[model samples]
Target: MTIKPFQVQNMLRHYGQHLDQGRRMARYRMLLQRASPEDVVNLSQDGRRKQLVEKIAAEIMDSLMVSGSSNPVVLEIKEELEREFGFGMEFRYLPLEPELQILRKEGEELTEVVGEEKQTILQRFWRITLAKVNETML
Candidate 1:
């Protein structure tokens, strides 16, 4: 079984790129507090799972700096996370120009409703977790 996509997105939103480092760690810890045995069935020990998840979070956050979606490093991390917690990370590319314009317009409207800072958070969240990695990175 796969970890819910939204759950994985939540983790990245709190821990991934564009977040201040100081806040990221704290947020990561906060995120971990919500994790339960149901989230990671393979690890019988909570401590072990916590440690592993922390490491993976850091790795994913760091990898997001150099690579976006389809990043091999992130892909590998995804595999490991799936094995451990059943987390699922799916790749998507930036939309075509026309679609992108529409998305950006919508995102702008969303920003107005959600606040600019929150929009940035959501942008980074989707960028790190969904945007496909560049071909050069391969």
Candidate 2:
């Protein structure tokens, strides 16, 4: 799960030269729409799935820094997320975080509204829970 500010900082710091700021942002939005919100990862137990997701997040940020955009790499990572830990994968459009909420110069709110009100909680950031390996399966 994303810890909001830290991840956003990574994106800004790791902006790519290839995708251009607009395209990179577009892709980022797209991915987030397809991901789940995770504020903290539980690593005391099975942590492999969380590690995999974190790896993908880091690589995508790194790729943007190095390769501008790597759609193939992103897609491959998505596939792996589903293939290995299908049980916990989730996707949905999420509301903007408090940090993203802003009053525009035009006296309008920058936060996107859904239906009539903004979503109160964002549970849409991508995260994973590694399943315990059962002896029977082993």
Models, CA RMSD each = 17.0, 16.0
For residues 52-81, what per-residue lDDT tens digits would candidate 1 score against the true structure?
555554445543433345766566544543
Model 1: lDDT to the true structure:
0.45
- Per-candidate count of clashing residue pairs (backbone under 3 Å): 1, 6
Task: Report lDDT (CA) for all predictions.
Answer: 0.45, 0.39
Per-residue lDDT of 101 in model 2: 21
Please report the TM-score between candidate 1 and the true structure. 0.26
Q: Over 4 Å off in model 2, which ranges?
A: 1-70, 87-93, 98-138
Listed in order, each prediction's TM-score against the native is 0.26, 0.22
lDDT for each residue of candidate 2 in 5-83, tens digit (9 for 90 to 100): 9888778555533234445467679877887767445565346655665556544433332342346544454345446
Candidate 1, residue 23: Cα displacement in angstroms equals: 0.4
